[model samples]
Target: MIMMTVLCIILGYLLGSIPFALVIGKLFYKTDIRQYGSGNLGGTNAGRVLGKKAGISVIVLDVLKVVLAAGLASLVSEPAAIWTSLACCIGHCYPIFAHFKGGKAVTTMFGFLISTSIFIFQEFSYFLVPLFMFLIILYLFKYVSLGSICASVCSSLYITAQLLSLDVNNLFIILASWLMTLLVIYRHNANIKRIQEGTENKVSWL
Candidate 1:
């Protein structure tokens, strides 16, 4: 069991460390995404550095990182699968291949949460509700971080509610949800401070 868990995590991390944004930037534009706007190898910065198309493509690829990880883990153990997925998210945030520098965890986190919520719980509402809320928040406020934070909180609340209603002691998932929430918020700390100072970058894609 322990060996499987460790292998799953390693596999997830390797998959997560692909650095698609960086690759895209270098291969097509002859630029380093990390040296561009926001200096982040993330979807938002990919848009800012390359274009909306690049950003969208990068997000799609980034999401696949977690999806692949989860799929691999699901073949081994159900519980290990979630942890492996999260490990992938973390890998995207701090990739070993990239000298531990990577994108914020939001995109990867959403990928895992959405995929798992739908497949495991047989409920698209759990993922869609928060996603709709995220879009609304982003459109109204123009702050991606703000929208992400709010949506993450809502997702956690909804998951907790679902577990409670089903009378399933899914403590691992409950804890995982909250932990992911906090991790995302923490990662957006700079954005939060900028928002407080009225200097946060308003996303232009919306």
Candidate 2:
């Protein structure tokens, strides 16, 4: 079991480290995406640097990597699988290939949520109430950082609620989710400061 768990984590991390944004940017536009925009290899930065279509593609690819990692992990036993998923999330946030600097793992978390089957489409209305409310607050105020922060907080809350309500036996899931939330918040520290100073970047869509 221990060996299997370690193997799963290594596999997930390798999968998560495939910088899709960087690859897509170079392939489509012959540019290093990290050189432009926020100097981060993430979908939002990709969008800001390479227009909407390329940005959306990068987002989808990143999300797909998360899904692949989590889904493969799910094929294993309970706690081990959860640990593997968490490892994947950590890899996205701090990829070894990128010198321990990576994206914020927002879309990766989205994929994790979707792959876990926590809230199906039928229950999405209930799940989305808080999500939409957060979006509104972020959109109206024109603070993308605030919106993302709120969203991550709400995601942790939702995950905790689900774990409790479902009586999940896997403690790793709870631990991993909490850890991932904290990591997301930590990654956004600069954004948090920008928000406090009233200088955070707003969504262009807003």
Candidate 3:
């Protein structure tokens, strides 16, 4: 079981480290996304540096990676699935294949929320609620960073509440959610500072 869990984690990290944003930017535009915009290897940066189509494609690919990782881990056990999801998020943030420099992992975190909600927790609301929250926040403010931060916080709070109400003894899900939330916040520290100074970039297309 332990060996299987380790293997699942390795698989998750490798999958998450695929760096779809970088790949799409380099392949289609002949530009490296890391050298442009916010220098983030995330979907939002992809949209800014590349185009809407490239950004959307990168986001879809990022989400799919987490879904695939969690699905494969679920074959082993729920704990493994949760761990794999966290591993994927970490890899997205600090990808080994990307010179250890990666995005903020906002999309990757939501990907985990979607995958774990379906494969491990069997609770769709965990994914849907945060997604709705993100969309509403994004539509209103046009700040992807703000929306992502809010969504990450909402996911953690919702998961914690659900675990409390349901009396679920397994703390792995809650741990993973909190970890991802912190990671999102940590990765967005620069953005947060910019927002305070009223210089944060807002999505012009929105």
Candidate 4:
């Protein structure tokens, strides 16, 4: 078990650190995505600096990293798997290769939630209702930071409610989820301030 857990952590971290946004940006645009637009190697920055296509590609790749890490970890042990998923999310948020700076891990968390098998469709539906709603709101308001924060909070709430009602055995998952949510929120502190001052960046279409 110990060996499996260690292996999962290492594998997940390495996988999560691929830095797809940087890669795609450099490959197609001949520039480092981190050099522009909020200076974040994330989908939002990718979209702003690169293009919508590059942004979507970055989002898919980031989410896939979480899914791959979590799924591989599950093969070891349930607890290890959950921890591995969280580790991957951490890696995405603060990639060591990128001077410990990275994206907010919003899409990565969504991937983890969707990949977990413990919850059935009903539970997932309850979770997704708020998630999708917030996404819509974000799109309408052009406040990606607010949307990401609200979605993370809603996900944590949904999981906590599931723990209370369904008696699911994995408190680690809930705890990890909350921790990641907090981390994401912390990374967005600047955005929060901009939002309060009504100086936050909005979508170009808006």
lDDT of 2 by residue, 1-206 (tens): 67877888898888777787788888889998778767777777877788888878877887777767766666676565556666777788778887777788766765655545432222453336445755787768866556656766776676567665544553456667677668778888988888888877776731
- What TM-score goes with each of the models? 0.94, 0.86, 0.95, 0.90
- Give the whole-model CA lDDT for all candidates, comma-separated: 0.82, 0.70, 0.89, 0.78
Q: Which stretches of candidate 3 lie over 4 Å from their true place?
A: 165-169
Q: What is candidate 3's lDDT per residue for 115-182, written digit by digit as tens?
A: 97899778899999999999998999788998899999999999888785544435777887898899
When sorted by lDDT, best at the front, the candidate numbers are 3, 1, 4, 2
Task: Kindly list the per-residue Cα lDDT of model 4 for residues 1-206, writing each as its tens digit.
Answer: 89889989888887777788998988889999787888888888888988888888998999888778877777777777767877888888888878878887767777666655342232566457557966786877889888888888887787677665533445776787788789779989999999999999987722
Off by over 4 Å in 4: 117-123, 165-168
- The ten-residue window of minimal lDDT in model 4 covers 117-126
What is the alpha-carbon lDDT of model 1 when measured against the actual structure? Answer: 0.82
Position 55, candidate 3: lDDT = 89
Better of 3 and 4 by lDDT: 3
What is residue 181's positional error in candidate 1, in angstroms? 1.0
Which numbered prediction scores highest in TM-score against the true structure? 3
Ranked candidates (TM-score, high to low) = 3, 1, 4, 2
- Residue 49's lDDT within candidate 3 is 84
Per-residue alpha-carbon lDDT of candidate 1 for residues 52-144, written as tens digits (9 for 90 to 100): 988998999999878888887877776667778778887888888888888887788788786677445667887897898889999899988
